[model samples]
Target: MTRHILIGLIALLPVQAAAGTIGKSEQVQACVLRQIDAAAPVADCVNEAQTECLDLVMKAPMASVACFRDARDTWNGYIGDRMAHISATAPTELAGVAGIEVKYDLLQNLMQCDRMIDLTLLREDPSEATEAQKARCEATATALAYVKLLLQSRNLN
Candidate 1:
């Protein structure tokens, strides 16, 4: 679980870095405020997205799988709720591109979380685990690629 948290946190490092340099759009901020006001578990998602949890997974691979499984459940819930909100409230036009981008990013993260769970459950031996990890990594890579395409479409319009 801790390892999963670490994995997520590690993934978020770039986001955290970019967050400070770029100002978020009003639409995105409004979405966040709504989530917070609704007391969604999204805040816990951010808290776990820090780098401090990575060592636990590195030290104990098998134990880490269990933790990853638990973490997946929490992440699944957060992503589901956020996706629902975004689907309902997200803007579809160019001026709302930032909000749409935020939704795309969240969708990518949701795919990553799904892959983490699949990798953990499919682990049998080191070789098999490696294969599973490769597959899961590919899934996330595909999601990111798609997100890039979506953003490009948004910008092209």
Candidate 2:
């Protein structure tokens, strides 16, 4: 029994680290930049914070929604930085940046409309969770859009 307890405690060490990871913008930047330096795909970093938040919350829905929101904001920041770099270095890419911004807005709007119908209409008792779910949908969509932009930025270099 003591051995089992000891193993369980040891397994949770990473969980403790993950708990402190979410909402730290600097951490997200470092994770992405490290992957870029290593020539690994930075796509994984886009979801790193969300994954850590989900692990910390044990898959609770509301908490998962918050994770998506945090992921959206962090990814957005990274996307903005990348775009600014492209615009500064390659001024000819202004049209490309504008196109990406339009696509991102459309992606978020479409996702919220399509995925949120069930939460808002089909549920027997629609509570505040419905709005929260919609918000999560938007955030998830925005993160997805940002991921695409970040991937494209790789080709600009």
Candidate 1 residues 1-157, lDDT tens each? 3334334533532222122211222333344445557887433323233122223345655444443333333333333333334334444443244334544565576677677656766755445344334433433333243233333333232
Cα misplacement distance, residue 84 of candidate 2 (Å): 1.0
Q: Among these predicted structures, which one has the highest lDDT?
A: 2
TM-score for each predicted model, relative to the true structure: 0.32, 0.53
TM-score of 2: 0.53
Query: Which residue pairs show collisions in model 1?
Result: 1-67, 1-68, 9-49
lDDT comparing candidate 2 with the true structure: 0.53
- lDDT per residue for candidate 2 within 27-123, as digits (tens), equals 6556767887899876566456566554534346666656655555555554455555555555454535544553555455556657666756775
Which prediction has the highest TM-score against the true structure?
2
**lDDT at 9, model 1:** 33
Poorest stretch of ten by lDDT in candidate 2: 10-19
Provide the clashing-pair count of each candidate structure: 3, 0
